[model samples]
Target: MPLRQTIARYFSDHAETNDSHTDPLLQTHYYKITADKGVTILESLFRNDPLYDIHASSSDRGEISATITERKKAFIVATVTMVKPLQTAIDFSVTTESFLRFDLGFSHKVIQRLYAHTDKELPLVKNIEQQPAHR
Candidate 1:
């Protein structure tokens, strides 16, 4: 990567999940569960965690918004979508609160840890149609 890009990544205060993200860590995660179940799993994750404060959640919309009130202050949104009866996709967007331009990849690390915990709660489903980038 170019120095500028590296610097931006290290300093960026925002991170989100994307299907074709250049960074594999930000790739969208699919799980083998229903959207409702996915939402329930995520809701419990925030409700049970002392560090997180769930601001709002909607099962109809399949969305959960929370704030990291401890350790590091940040806002996060988790989106759950049902692709099939038993297949669901979960995406997370995190933005850290700070006066500085970046948090040294703190937001990135938060997403990674969230994914790790989620992976344990629900089975991960690999992409069925992963296509290589054109050279």
Candidate 2:
């Protein structure tokens, strides 16, 4: 299935079960993959800008890392650090909520954009083989 359809089906089937606190219209899944020691810093920074539309080209230097963990269920976490030339890095995480809250078309488009933005950082993930993973 296309990402859009898959996302919608996912939300329809799973949203309410996650929690009563999770709004079916605003349910969000969190992804947090990080380097061995960098998870803490990444988590802190990402929580600050969960929905920020950051671009990869905006940074001069940065790191990309991820980790997969099971919290009630399986989820992947992606950490991005966009560093400006000689400046402190702007780090954040993008989350894919289990529940579908937004329009499927919009959700798919946004994710596609983020996917392209992330692929630009391929040079950054040198040690590990890049996986064809998506939320």
Candidate 3:
């Protein structure tokens, strides 16, 4: 099963509480890349894609915020942190503007798509196996 489906199932099985304060789901994924490169790639992706509207970005700070309008408006904030010379962490926070408080795994789908796009755009370091998420 897809990660998003798995997460949704887990939440459903556990009877996870949904509160107004926590309506926006936050997800973090680590990628193998420098912070600078990560920010550049994200900027390019967001700027080039018609689906995303860039709200704010600071390459120096390694952060990008954008908004996407599908059935609902989704606000996305992505941050890149350098953990090592070539290891970086990417965090994505997605909030949807909806009448209902819960997203029913919409945020997870956004994160999964973003992560897949990043992986496709950026090539891995030569002879280095991709590492799993750190923490």
Best by TM-score: 1
Better lDDT candidate (1, 3): 1
Residues 32-96, model 2: lDDT tens digits? 33332233444443344444422322122334333222232212223333223221212223343
In order, the Cα lDDT scores of the candidates are 0.91, 0.33, 0.68
In model 3, which regions exceed 4 Å deviation? Answer: 1-27, 123-135
Best by lDDT: 1
Clashes of 3: 0
Against the hidden reference, what TM-scores do the models get? 0.91, 0.26, 0.69
Kindly list the per-residue Cα lDDT of model 3 for residues 1-135, writing each as its tens digit: 567656663343111211121223323445678899899999998988888999999988888999886575788888888877886767777776666666666666777688789868775342222246569
Worst 10 residues of 2 by lDDT: 13-22
Clashes of 1: 0
Quality of model 3 by C-alpha lDDT: 0.68
